[model samples]
Target: MFPKTHLTIAAGATVLVAATVLMSPSSNVEAKRMSYALDLEQGSVSAPAKGPASADEQNSGEVKTDTASSSAPTSGEKGQTEATVAAAPSEPALDWQAFEIKSGDTLSSLFKAAGFNDGIMLSVIHGEGDADKLQRLYAGETIRFASDDQGKLAAVELQRNRLKSLKVSRTDDGFKGQILTREPEARPMFASGVIDDSLYASARAAGLNDKLTMELTDIFGWDVDFVYDVRKGDRFEVVYQDLYLDGKKLGTGKILSARFINRGDERLALLYTDDAGNSDYFTPDGKSMRKAILRTPIDARVSSPFNLQRRHPVLGVVRPHEGTDYAAAPGTPIKAAGSGRVISAGRKGGYGRAVVLQHGDGITTLYAHMSRIARGMKAGSRVKQGQTIGYVGSSGLATGPHLHYEYRVNGRPVNSRTVKLPDAKPVPSSEMAQFRKVADQRLAQFNVFEGREQQLAMAEEE
Candidate 1:
């Protein structure tokens, strides 16, 4: 209803106002630009977005401080060279998480301390999954506690057995745990030592312990009695396998080579296992170290017997004793002189805590003054040849701590000090040929295991 002149003039006024506003720079207007920089890949540090933020007002509050980033150019500055930012490298998840178990720490309490919720720890510890492992929640053992970004615990690993690491990523029904298995690893190593003193002492000086010592003894046990067989200046060299997992050593896997020299007699053995899983030690000449029986039957520490006619500490008697006695430190182990049965294990006059073993062919051996008898050691219990019967002590008419040991032939005491025991049982006349062949094969393996110098010197010593 308005005149044409009024409508036309109103439109012209709106257009002119829009033009002015577009030309003006408003204070609220923002132009955003992105920035980036190079940085070394040190894991454990979180990285932020590298792209530019949009100039939109809605997204302004979403930005965090970008670490490892360079600042952008300022306004009104001429463009300079822009260094292309390297892409941030990726990092794998952590292997273990450290956790300490305080007193009264049950599985439930530990799960809470490790930032876990209800039911997860109990399920895993109690084997709700297919792990089929025994549950362990000891107070001192550490465990590794791990979780995913969503905060679910995946697996649990004992951290040095004091702390637990739980990985909640792979559990059944969505609970995860540590990787369960690994491939087997085998490695070879060599050790050599000269016996300046005792074989065990020298081996220990060369960094061997109970486990390794047992390994060494087992390698040569078939050939050497170890107790009464080693001579001074005896040298031993062995090459064995070291078993490992994740680069950590577990134990000695096997003994490949071993050499022993007793009284200037040379004996070298190698370990050999046939296709049928039969293994033994044998000399290079194809002789089995395993005779029908071991030559020396005692496990005594000393080679010489006690001299009773000298100074007497308690009895004060200058009587020349008829028997040789062994002095073991109060409770040292005492073994049988041979495969025998208990003739008597009870007290006999001054032979306090004594045990008498009777072997076949009218031979009897006696041990006296024991600290205590091995449990269940009675007259009827069958004992193996080298099994411990009692500890050593001063019992009968003795001066100090020692075992009064006597050897008897046909019920009469004899000088065990001078008696030469019988030789090894010859291999069954029928099994002799096969035994020699088996022995030779083992000896060949031993040579391959020990290097050249060891073989030569061992040969000379033998």
Candidate 2:
């Protein structure tokens, strides 16, 4: 390479290294896995970047102009739908067969039955973090595994955005496996709902989730709250992407549009376009959700501790507390730290009137010292994050009213608030351009979706 070219390469490596250092932990879950090995001493880029197969391939938007086309949003469209383009007319005889799982079928067994030998099955499973990571595939969720023009495994795509739509292919596999990744389409849409009873109830009624409900609150939590802020007749709506692969569903992507009505006031939000045309959720007037830091650390101050034994203030005896306590007042509503459901909503020993939530992954929490439970609160009810289930009252063995909180990993008491949460994220820089491209298209379509809704409402004389 020429000396000028070498300088250009060296400069490029520096920016990537800087990005690794400055990358936000919340922006991408995969950031931790990125380790920059730049040789600053010589100002030389790494061998990986030097090779023909490099991480910059897709990030640079150097997608192959092959027959395998991706569904993208066209600019200026007000509304859009899930547009899928499968193998067109019968030309190459691409045997794209869809398989529904049988009771006795495993990935390995099925691949063998398909005449490809199960050699790729083991690797595929591990790469997917097992079948559960493969869109939580239980007994029934189907995957449309396919091959390309080269007859090599084109991709193993899930039918929905329940989990990520994963694909693996190779440019070359010499000493190392040369892989190329094609991101599935993640399109934006507009969704809205009203809560006559509770957040989770409303979300489920609107075809959403306790998880998505929590996410919406989190996005706007710096302003509106899930507890006292939620009025009896509050309402909400949102625009987020539904990720897909080869027309198959992968899962919901980031939110693009949102509306939360507390009392009678409506708060409308839209995804704004940046200088680079990258889209991020913003208020209708345009304000970024990227805060300097989270409002609270893991949990509220003095909310919880990790001690097993404590000197009982009233009992005057050293006993196992088994949970940390948050100091608050009676009727101080408690909210879920994340999206989850109520497993228990009544009293417990010494803890007084308590509420317990069973978040997924064997994680659970206990909220105590309640003066009274929220109206319509009960076991088996879903709760969005920060949604109020009860108030703080001196009901249990307490000097005053406060919330006793506990976080459990597996079956052990891990501080729920302080749990160093695992991270996943936005598209990598290597994947950013294409990611933004699709996101832009989705944003445009979302406007149209909302417009049609307004038109329909008008037609009904609402």
Candidate 3:
């Protein structure tokens, strides 16, 4: 618009007026033509148009200058003058707009906010593949909308996480969906900590998360009694996997190796997976780190020991207390001591809400006084070792929230504690060599990290 078309016409008109004057008695028309040309070059002639002025020109109170048309040829030059205007190239238009999902926002509401109706939203939701996942949008996620020139929905993108997303695009008949994913880079990491007060505090100080801390306890739970044996000076070292994407940390994976020092005894657990895809922790000598049963199922102190002549606190008389009582907070999970099948999972006379597991060699374990049994845990259901079977609660004849754990051999109640637990099967002879090689390598890594830590400590002391 700044290159005004009116200027070209005005210049031609000036030439025409000059020629008409030359044909008259005025012989100075040539001089007038040159004067008009000079005026045109200096932009002295005002160009008047019928249309209202543009906002820019009106606000500034100035006329728009068209440099290209300012030097336009006059009508007297040759037959006439014509200007060839070139078309400008167009730029690509952006059609996508992104919106962050907030709490309580549904797919319908999001579509409406993106300027779409329920019909379009339903079309997207019913698209092929993972398009239905849009209905399960979570807070802190992102959703993008792409529209056509007519402002109709063209495509929809749902960013679920850094590693995964779903995109749905409009097609002739309906919508088409496709899922996208990215793989994270896995790297080895090392951490070591000396317990000052508790395991959780020390592990956190050493940069271990809650999941890794719990996993560490589980790896060594069979050998060391974490509830009573962990002391102030007990230390731990772990080599684990840290996942990353484009140099940014995502989360942690699995622990490769861990060493725990409890009560002046060192226990090492190295993770190894066989060719058959079976994975478990093993000692340096190829012995399985697992036992026939866990030392204690719940993370709590023993309130009552198994005694044949102990007086019952609730009965107020001398009664044979056969099971050991573990006192924990209400609703604390009680894990299975070993893999077994449930023989009974109901209320007993004195023990309310009890579950008895049938094991090999005529061994059976009993868990009594639960707030409630875990789902899928019923009679004849098989359970794995360390699986949660019930919660801690004083169900029937009890004083407070506690678990009465009994380990019976051939229907005879035995002391749950002080009884030597049988060892689990060791590494298969076919894979012993492979396990030893992996264990040695992982243990070497642990040693290297330990040496580096010790050196740093000594340097700091000096």
User: Which candidate, 2 or 3, has the higher TM-score?
Assistant: 3
Q: For residues 305-386, what per-residue lDDT tens digits would candidate 2 score against the true structure?
A: 6566777877998876777677775666676655577888888888788787777667677777788888766888887656
> Candidate 1's error at 60, in angstroms?
61
Ranking by TM-score: 3, 1, 2
In TM-score terms, which candidate is top?
3
lDDT of each: 0.62, 0.61, 0.85
What CA RMSD would candidate 2 show? 23.3
Q: Which of 2 and 3 is the better model by lDDT?
A: 3
Of the candidates shown, which would achieve the greatest lDDT relative to the real structure?
3
Tell me the tens digit of each residue's lDDT in model 3 across 1-462. Answer: 545778888888999788644444332322233211113223355434344556875576544446754443456642333222112113223378889999999888888898998998998989887788778888999999988767878889999999999889877878988899989998989999999999999999999999999999889988777767799999999999999998999999899999999988998899999989988888888888888888788888899999999999988899999999989999999999999999989888789999999988888999999989999988899999889999999998999999999999999998877787878888999988888889889988888888898899999999
Candidate 1 residue 270 C-alpha distance from true site, Å: 3.1
Give the total clashing residue pairs for model 2.
Answer: 21
Better of 1 and 3 by TM-score: 3
